[model samples]
Target: MSNSPAQDTLAQDFVAFAVESRVLRFGEFKTKAGRLSPYFFNAGLFDDGAKLGRLAEFYARRLVASGLQFDMLFGPAYKGITLAAAVSIELARLGQNKPFAYNRKEAKDHGEGGTLVGAPVQGRVLIIDDVISAGTSVRESIEMIKAAGATPCGVTIALDRQEKATVTTATGPQEAAESAVQQVQGQYGLPVVAIATLADLMGFLDVQSDAALVSARPAVQAYRQRYGV
Candidate 1:
């Protein structure tokens, strides 16, 4: 829970980067949990070559700084596919070469084909993704890693909402005690690391000079108070 100065700075910078890229937008956005959020982070917007390369740098830096050991990276599917590949390339560029693999949404039935692609999953594999929303992707990734006879060391993500997860009940949707990130950590016993979190976004908003962005700070703070873990 204690973040070093460098880590804090990196988080702040990442927030700024997201904003500049228009990947992190301030507006009334409906979440999967059905809560109205003040801001939204869309990692898929890191589309172009330069943006993706820079985004990967942030991920690699945070993972390395966390000191979590992993022999390879596993991207679940869809969004994570690009994230894992880019991060692995960044790590290798930083002189820490590591293999990475990703899963297909559906199993293929062709030459050298299956659900998995790229390097074989082995050893302490780290799951990479954009964020932990419902935690479905992380769960699936863990299952695949174990099936491959690999050990899942931990998970790395771009942002942590840090808000309690929602569960559908007979009464209606209800908030759980722990966030999606927390659920993943507790359920699978793996560390869920992030480059930035909701708290960091709040911090960024506090010092932001943009009149429009600053005006949304109150809404963000209220949302965090209502649902933060």
Candidate 2:
């Protein structure tokens, strides 16, 4: 479904915020998958309290706008922990208080812990993260939720790259690949919501009068044309 006018504005505003925060950068950068990308978004840059708080606001807004209902939020190890905590706080501020949880990378052998922490995993749970380059994190989270007898209803992320995903087949590998977001939805039958996308970033760049941004637009567009879903 298409976003409403208000949602579109918020998405654009997020792109602006990302640029100002230097979280979204335009340049030549190699991805984990070994592809050189024109632009890169590093959620790890939102490290300070103020930056994290503002980032959470964008996530909360997108989640509410998505109309996806869930009983709780689950963040994976590391980055997911911060994202889940911050988003829960923001959601509460937006009048939707929900429990949040996270897991340790290794199972803790002491204290009140096994692997999971925070609220008990129950009902429909939403997994929050910075991005989904591969489906591995999401798969791990799904297993954890099922192990706890909780249902994983959806996933929320800061941005969607919308690039083609490579997959193994019986013969060799599938040349026709789906995007990471598409793979998650197809495999799990759950919605993946993002505050912004590559398309939105390109749109933002398109309207800018800055010489650098204007010059960088074609590179990003070319990358999208080659790999976008």
Candidate 3:
């Protein structure tokens, strides 16, 4: 990256790579939470060294570009565990080695065992993950951070799917999610940061992508209309 990246460079690369990596895909799929999504971003698909390595690089770059301040990073469980580890490692490769920790869904009841592994979670902790859908994970992660005697700072994700509803009829998913993320920030003083949002995705798709997505845009728009905050 250059000293000054182009406007929305992070957003563009994230959307492009996400599409290229197929880590996040658009299809009819059932989520763990049982919501039928027209699109899904499965971070678990980031399993190889190259893909994982690139992902961390992007995450690290975004972090630097974001100017977020935090003593540590936290992932929720399972998927989050891997993301946090990779991003922390990538940051280290950039000569900014920051300690990282993650939780196991089932805790080990033995000596030297605790919910969080690796460095002890201390001071301000930023939660990193793939995306924020309904904000459930964000809320739970906040509680867990407080439980560990640390301050939950902000959330960084590859994307932000605005699922909250908006008041103005013209407001779309982006606006709704912006509202929800703001509420969360106001409630806990923590920000939800993402590389891209619906607007970014739409912007990329509108001019360069296929007519299929262009024609199918309304379903996504409808989803935002119904569920956006």
**Which is the leading candidate under lDDT?**
1
Q: Residue 147, candidate 2: how far off, in angstroms? A: 0.5
Using lDDT as the measure, what is the rank order of every candidate, best first?
1, 2, 3
Listed in order, each prediction's TM-score against the native is 0.98, 0.96, 0.82
- Which candidate has the highest TM-score of all? 1
The 10 consecutive residues of candidate 1 with the worst lDDT sum are 1-10
Predictions in order: lDDT: 0.94, 0.92, 0.75
Regarding lDDT, does 1 or 3 come out ahead? Answer: 1
Instruction: Write model 3 residue lDDT over 1-229, tens digit each, in one string.
Output: 2223443777777777887888767757775445566777777787899998888888888888778888888998877888899999988888888888888777788977777787898899999988765567788888888998999889988776666523335553233445556566777777777777776676666665576666656666665566554
For model 1, how does the per-residue alpha-carbon lDDT over 1-229 read when each residue is reduced to its tens digit? Answer: 4579999999999999999999999989999988899999999999999999999999999988999999999998899899999999999999999999999998999988789999989999999999999999988999999999999999999999999998779999888999999999999889988999999999999998889998999999999999999
Error of 2 at 199 (Å): 1.0
Instruction: Give the Å shift of residue 136 in candidate 3.
Output: 2.8
**TM-score rank order:** 1, 2, 3
Q: Write the per-residue lDDT of candidate 2 for residues 95-121, one digit (tens) a residue.
A: 999999999998888898599999999
RMSD of 1: 0.9
Which candidate do you rate higher for TM-score, 2 or 3?
Answer: 2
